[model samples]
Target: MNKKILFVDDEENVLSSFKRNLRREFSITTAPGGHEGLEIIKNQGPFAVVVSDMQMPKMKGSEFLAEVKKISPDSSRILLTGYANIENAIDAVNHGSIFRFLTKPCSNEALISALHEAIRQNQLLTGEKELLEKTLKNSINVLTEILGMVNPAAFGRANRVKRYVNQIARLLKLNNIWKLDMAAMLSQIGFVTLPNHILEKVYHQEELSAKERNMLAEHPEIGAQLIKQIPRLEDVSQIIRNQNTDFSEHQKISTPLAPVQKFIVLSSQILKVVLGFDEMIFRGISKPSAMSILKRDKSKYNPKVVDLLEHVQISEKERMQKTLALAQLKSNMLTNQNIISLQGKMLVAKDTELTDPLIQRLKSYDVSVGVQQPIKIFV
Candidate 1:
């Protein structure tokens, strides 16, 4: 793909001249001023390089480039102006994250060379970010998969809570949701330290001894410690640590959170509510009764998150339900009810999305031990 370049100047003639000079050599877009440049950055951004005149009316190039850095941090920024000074250069470099500063009346060859260098820098930055994210995601997935095998009850809760996390995130129109999803998946990783019998007791809602209760209560902190070892997972770890925290305690002790941190906390709260509901359902309580119990303690959760949780539940109920034979099941179809074996063990959890490997496993089970037929699924 051709690298995209944006040029912003208050002077129409300067912008026109840039288009004339560089349009043939690059994919050039021009904006009249900083405000228009910001608009383009929002609506049609991800540009390889953004060049802005330093002294535009209303908003300066430094401020415009700073906003661009927030919106598209990988986009290389350049400041071009006749009023170049040490102060302006410092501000542009520090605040605008500028890759290059050019004086007015710059030659075509110099500007072209700068643009080429800016594009290279943008590509390197974006490539590194993508690789880091991919590697982190794969590592998290492997850890969660191992946890799932070791303690299905705990990891199953993670899987179920992840569905609610995604739903609530979409309801709130949040971005970079994979972090929240990762937090949810690894929220119960600390349970790996406990014995399977202890987890089983917790899953079944059996009464616990004082020691067991203390250990159980420590799981969130333990999970946080384990996750914090991974780079770029500090926020995720903090979210896990706060999963069981009361809002009042959070308010008292925690530092002011960033938007992403706030979202992580919100996701953690939603997971608590959903996990409670899941436990109640496992104990044969009705969904409405479980939800009512959760709402009665309103101070424990953010009201907006609770409202969105309710909305998610309502939306889930409205999904198309069908009963199909094992041979008819397809990928991405969610289980509407738990699939149980003749021995009464749950083979698949409710709301679990079927995949090709899982389908094949179920087929093998059907042939070997015989699974219950006419499985219920949500379309």
Candidate 2:
């Protein structure tokens, strides 16, 4: 409901006249030219409507409005020009995405009407954006919840990798990183398709058969296929698909790419590095040793992302291991030793983070067939 209006023109009298006439009807701000207008937009902007004179010194309205769109896409733009510049105004409307244009000598009433319509358009755009964000969040929540229930190990691994990705993103000072976060969280979604026994073997670092290894290799593709079905997640899917790809593969793209394409490549590289690092940790590799190993395989990982690992502070609390009874276990605690049943089978893998579903499953197994206790835990 931000009905704030910004008027950009080179003439001082026109700006003064706009404030004099429209001050009572709207929240108005004026800038002398495109440069000043841009500064205003950056500092005190997201104005509901931005009206600019089509012919201005140094920067044309079309150029100014185009920059405004990049800075504040929700702000509806309007071009004001003389009748002689009608063609240019039309071009601006098409290219600059101006909401509308007003010819010279426009009546005050006509200007007011355009302002109202522009405000309405802004509201619609903002409302739609909010709705889409809410929907996307809810969708991701549902998917993660399902993953937690279907495959607790994979779900826990995804959450852990997401934390690492967040740490790396923070170290890099990345902006607007929700897409990267989403890619991290859903990177292992393909595990949902694999049998629980296969996942257990993978988590336990047990030797895999040729078939099992092949199945595991196909996971990224399966995950990508499942995720690409969702709207607006094509980039995320691509990131997931490439999460296992080597850094050398990303370097193969010699041609220039769009900004989004570059972001996807960077995101995939981050996921790849984090996933590999997490695997080493899960296998009982020390942080320093894991980093050294990653450094040794220079072509396998993005060195920049791997370098950020040195800064990520591993929690000291997770290292203090203790033994607890099966009944005493709680969520979020890391398992220091594999939980084995009385029958000599591994119930849970070492280094696995406990989730609610995992805890419930262990409790149920303990009841049906006793689990050896006390279980070793990080807490």
Cα displacement (angstroms), candidate 1, residue 220, comes to 1.3
- How much is the lDDT of residue 293 in candidate 2? 91
Q: Candidate 1 — worst ten consecutive residues by lDDT sum?
A: 307-316
lDDT of 1 by residue, 238-266 (tens): 88888887655545645787766666667
Q: Candidate 1: lDDT over CA atoms?
A: 0.79
lDDT of every predicted structure (CA atoms): 0.79, 0.87
Instruction: Report the C-alpha lDDT of model 2 over 147-189, residue by residue, as the tens digit.
Output: 7667666776787788789889888866458788898889888
Q: Residue 336: error of model 1 in Å?
A: 5.3
Q: What's the TM-score of each model vs. the native?
A: 0.80, 0.77
Error of 2 at 153 (Å): 1.4
